[model samples]
Target: MKSNINVVFFLFIWGFLLACTKAADPGSTVIIDPVVDVDYSDTSLRLQDVAPFPIGASVSFNHLSNDPKLAAILYANFNELVFNSELKHGALVKADGSFDFTTADAFVDLAKDMDIYGHVLAWHRHQGTSYLNTLVGNLEQQELLLDPGFEKSTTVGSPYWFVLNSGDPKGTATIAVTTQTDEVKSGTSALKVVNPTAYGTADWRVQVASNNFQTVPGQKYVIRYTAKSLSGSGIIMVSAQAMDGSGVTHYPGGDKTITGEWQTITLSFTPTKENYRIVFNMGKKADTYLVDDVSVYSEVAAPDYAAIYTRLDEALHTFIGTTVGRYKDRIRKWEVVNEMFTDAGEIRSNANSPAPIVDGQKEYGYFIWSEFLKRDYGYLAFRYAEEADPTAELYINDYGLEYSDKKIDSLIAYVNEIRKRGAKVDGIGTQMHIDIHLSQAKIDKMFQKLASTGLKVRVSELDIRITNSSTPMPPTEALLEKQKEQYQRVVASYMKFVPPAQRAGIAVWGVLDQYNWQYNGGSDYPNLFSTEYKKKPAYGGFLMGLSEK
Candidate 1:
């Protein structure tokens, strides 16, 4: 766009009223305004200036900041910028959960003049894999608690965590599963125990114990849980009891005092028996107690599920909040989550590297945040972004939306679901990275589905590749023409289907073919510009699409 900016010259013509002499009002000379003409012709127009919605292009911050010519082209045309990899998790976040925002800070400075959209706050790949995996420490310890939180409990009773004895004393005693919001300390439900009788006469009045679990002698085990009572005060006793004939019992963390306020309890001890059960001696108290997130594991290894959850949750918060907050006033849009689903639209699976580590993460390693935090993590991440920058338009971007029905639908469904869960997902970004041969029908359907959602729709990454099967590199003219038409169709479809109120904008994937990332250092040519930074035929076609009615 900048290369030809000079061709869009203005024509200034001075018109003299020579005919005024014939009609004549003597010294009162008739004057005419200079004729100014601006050529809106294809050869001279700029995509960013011509498009109704903002036009964006992905570029390397290094090239954008260091290479003046490339930077000039971007500044001359694009209004919004997407960094190729600098803004991603692996690029900014360290293995130790620290951030290096120096480059991103400079990008924010550039955003002062233009716009910079947040690439991602959470994703499966390009992650702080080491830090995340480290948090989910090793598999050295196995959980030994059966239905610890009473999740197996039906309305009637729990199968694994069952009532051993009740109503043995003067007072009534029973155990039930509670799903009340206030009663649940961690997960969706908690175990509710009420003992109306103080078990001073016989502690067996009400005994709710977990099914006995096998234990190894000399193995250390820890149980962590939160307990609270309806009233302001109560006393409860927890014990680890041997199921053997000896009937010996041990209080790992000793007895506990339950209160109106929830209190966390951690019981750690080494087992000296073959099998034992965790007992809630609530018969000692006459008040109702709620317990949740009761996890019992033996020993700490490199990674633990509970530990991983805590660390990753914190990391997710830090990554979203700190990064978004730093540029709260600068950026207008952010991808709170990206590519969370597979091509088949299922939640992505957990995976580790096939390659060794470099920097912080391995090339093939994946830390599926969704796998660890679950779907609710989306809401949490969105909330963090919202809190950091209330004005930013938050989005969750994904690829294959145009080609895969499952991918597209599931993404839309997930977006809607999270929105209902209080995530302010202002938009959904479809990364349309395709080949010139992509079906127009799929494009139409994809756009139609996105527009119907009424959320801001963005062509987050637009690039039409010319595969080797279709054409050879130094791409044949015919394929280039298809590329041109493909570009036009994308922008035109976006405009035609998405209402003006919902148009977030369209962003070309990259500036030049060589750096297109499709076949980096290879034959891939998937951008609007040639390697020389010269605008190609697709640029004009894209402009035409933006000019569409």
Candidate 2:
């Protein structure tokens, strides 16, 4: 009776609760999601704002025009722009040795309110090499034939000259080596060929080809030799074949008759290719041919130093003065002379240079400006920059100074020496293209020495080389941390050692690590931005170093 009563009471209570709550009609009304607050104040950070001095970036002109994101980062961060290459000699000067500043002028136009830093006035590399070479002129293409007069050997041999063929009938003709006064020409020895059978019009039938000699393209070569025929006035065909197995034949003055008396045969032809073998075909008239005094010459002008010096001196004045004068209104700072000293602490000249005026060739890669102008090259560059803009802050810049005590000392000394000579060098830039693990002690020491000079000091071309391996590798957080630390340490050291007034500024070589000039194959972590244009840890680290939170 008690259980029945309890059950009835529970049922009644459950029914009453269900009646009171009617399960909110499924999906009848929807609830809205609440708006959340987020912070992105850090993303708005600009490097130029925190840095004490101008934060510069060596920027590419094409990227500014093509990549909007890259341009945004550039405009947002950097206050000064260093043209990656537009102002370079090779870029501005055409092959004809004339200035074409269309691209350079357009590059300056992108610097809206930003200062322009004239990269260089004089440099051996990135120069108009062909034009400079033309100024000096290449020496005559001297003798190409090893043994011009067949003087190397009295008999036919392989090393110097080789007689390729005997005759058409297999043994109808004999190639005899003789030093007889009647047979030989200028040299003591000569090649005497006796052909008894006439394989008329079959020029290659009785052939004696000389050993191959290297030929230059478009080089007008003159082959001069003395020849005589025993049978009066017999046709001896001379043809040239490429020794490189190209099967290409050059028959400029091939088919000609040799008189009974020894006569000089001059054959002139500009080669279309390289590696040529001279061929003599004497089977046309069944004659005994005596050939001697073979000489191959190319009429190339000798280098005239006086003329070269004059042309280049005038060219230097024009390149520097004209470029700076045009941009004087916008650019007030200039790197007057770059890389004037070798890593060995010695001044670079022809004696220390590899591209000295070569004997029979032209150097198109490097032109040592000091080879002609001597130490006065830098002096002249400074003079030219001063002449262009009297108020411009002129700097002499170089690399490898952080590690090389001798190099730093040499640069300082040279600057002092040049200043005495009336070259107004206003600053010195140490391109701190260092690695992450580069000794802090070395960096401090370098800063100390630079600070001692009392000239404006700049860390130009700042980038950290993560790895020494040429092969590409995946980047690691540890490596990145080290790069960040390096970037921070370098900045802090500049502030610690260099006086505030003398800090010309620290210019990160590139805005992004992957955009790094050195980052071709492998991953490089050198800049403040990642390859995706995202801010890197190095960016915060650099900001921290600038005394920013």
Candidate 3:
């Protein structure tokens, strides 16, 4: 069975490459007579023997399902890694702050049940400030002496402590109750003891915490919430606190009146230190405080090449044995989640920071992306993906880890942050787009820092554009060679750090130049193959470099 397949594979690729190069490489273009038959009895050679995993390719879902042979061809030629934008965290978290685990959870379950590996989590934005307000309110309230450190006294004691009944001479003090075991029985039961005298002057003591401070040091996090006062009026205070070995520290806070109509609040913070806890308290002495959909989270980390690799593990398995099943393993090798970053191609900082990349300034990217890397979803997504697919390799795919120092620096910090939190990120992808003028030494040092975390590395997206900056496109041979050299240096540096077993692989963005995204130029024409499906000169150069001992 193996021998027959090998004969077929050799015949096909040999014929294909031969046909493709007939006009150029005359020595390799000699046409064999079709009538000359050769015996292929030995089935010893296998696909894995030639290439352990197939050279992978990236394709939109629409393409794979639309073409029957294309899927099989991908499975035969390479291992697969998929780019699924739907599994990102922003889409997963609901407006109420609790995760809308439906799609993400389904993706994970399908990976296990189907055996394809891919992303279970991504660094999409998640700001549940509305839900987080309530969370912080609860956390801050916990810090203060909200309950007086004891339950209500059933028997009468001092006037300061005795439970007062409705209209019992004392000024009316509204009290809210939250029944944990069961829903509160309303009417008079929910308001059994409202001190009538307690309300005249603000003498009663109730704890109030700031509703704002929400963060997780070195772990990306976000939270938001919206709630309505079902029946009564109450002053709600919320705040943030640091959870120390001793207890919570209340600081920086906010509050508002939760009117009967639903009120929405948003809270976004990245904790560089351990001060990422939120607390809340209700001021009404005797009002039933009803809360719903309280949400809390560390910030969501942006998807870098490293994280993309991690997510692919689950994606591969999820697609296995399904219509897209055969390409699962290949997809695990080199899948590109295009534009996973913000439109400007940078990670977002906290909510207050600008969206994605603001005006292409490195500061804007750093301000937001740094916060994201340090404490946002950087840790959580890795944790989940690691648990979901232990054997599958993963990467955080991105478009601009190459020429941008701010991006590179933040990425390093982000990688470090996740490492501190114990993530299994295996590599860093510098989506090679333009011909970067980075010093080899500087690039080497960056890899060294990333390697210190003990991860594999990759040049996830390798495109070279030499068109106008105003209207960017692919490059000419002269331009492409320079781009190729840039890629060669990067791949070379990456090879220095990665061990053979850990090396999943590297890939060109597209097979044909025409199909490549040169039109979106930052010096396009970076691909090793031309638009006509012919290997560019760089293709031979890369094959030689990659094959070097």
Q: Highest lDDT: give the candidate number.
A: 2
RMSD of each: 17.0, 17.9, 17.9
Which residue runs of candidate 3 sit more than 4 Å off their true CA positions? Answer: 1-54, 66-77, 84-120, 125-347, 350-353, 356-376, 390-399, 404-410, 436-443, 471-475, 518-523
Each candidate structure's TM-score, on Cα atoms with residue i matched to residue i, is 0.62, 0.70, 0.43
Q: Higher-TM-score candidate among 2 and 3?
A: 2
What range of 10 consecutive residues in model 1 has the weakest lDDT sum? 6-15
Q: Rank the candidates by lDDT, best first.
A: 2, 1, 3
Off by over 4 Å in 1: 1-41, 140-304, 351-365, 468-472
Task: After superposing candidate 2 on the true structure, give the runs of residues whose Cα lies further than 4 Å from its correct spot.
Answer: 1-44, 139-302, 355-365
Clashes of each: 7, 0, 120
Candidate 3's TM-score reads 0.43
**Candidate number achieving the greatest TM-score relative to the actual structure:** 2
Candidate 2: minimum summed lDDT over ten consecutive residues — where?
Answer: 32-41
The local distance difference test score of model 2 is: 0.80
